[model samples]
Target: MIDKIKRIVEPVVQDFNAELVGVTLKGAKRNYILIVFVDRIGGVTIEDCTKISRQLSKEQELDDLLGNNYRLEVSSPGMDRPLKTPQDFKRNVGRFLEIEFEDKAGLHKLK
Candidate 1:
């Protein structure tokens, strides 16, 4: 579901010269919330979010990708955002991080 949404919205975000950071779907069946996080080299602005939201809304409406009752939200990934990709890690270089592995190797904390 998320991958599909990403494929649909990423181009729109890129058109604005921003990176599509992540997408999340939340809430109940009929009240699903679609959250899109975007970022850029100089960071994102409210105007940028609004533009992306409007464009994405139009695209979604045309495609009916999310069904009828979903609310779309576009915004920046906040300070405590999860690091999901190598690019995310690279962007946050020199920052502190706590990493955990599932191979029984205990938690690894880094700075």
Candidate 2:
């Protein structure tokens, strides 16, 4: 399901001169979440979200790809996507963030 979503979104992101930062699926059963990430500056507007959502929804509906009872969510990563790599941190420098690390247990501010 996730791979299918990625295939559909990647081109759209690239067309907008953005990259797919990441994609996440969380939840069990019928209520599922689809969180998409894009390397966007100045954050993505609601219109952008709507456009991407509509495009993806249309693709999914046309192909009947999901093939199950589930919901779809389309949005930018916000500040929660994390700076997994140094490049990520570099790109998001000076922005407010809430980070929860796996290896180290601490919340530190980034600049």
Candidate number with greatest TM-score: 1
Q: What TM-score number comes out for model 2? A: 0.63
Cα RMSD, model 2: 4.1
lDDT of each: 0.83, 0.67
For residues 57-91, write the lDDT of model 2, one tens digit per residue.
66654246444665667667665554677757766
Model 2: residue 81 alpha-carbon error in angstroms:
3.0
Error of 2 at 72 (Å): 1.8
Candidate number of the best lDDT:
1
Model 2 misplaced regions, further than 4 Å: 27-32, 60-63, 93-111
Q: Tell me, what's the RMSD of every candidate? A: 3.4, 4.1
Q: Whole-model lDDT for model 2 versus the true structure? A: 0.67
Q: In model 2, how large is the Cα lDDT of residue 1? A: 73
Question: RMSD in angstroms, candidate 1?
Answer: 3.4
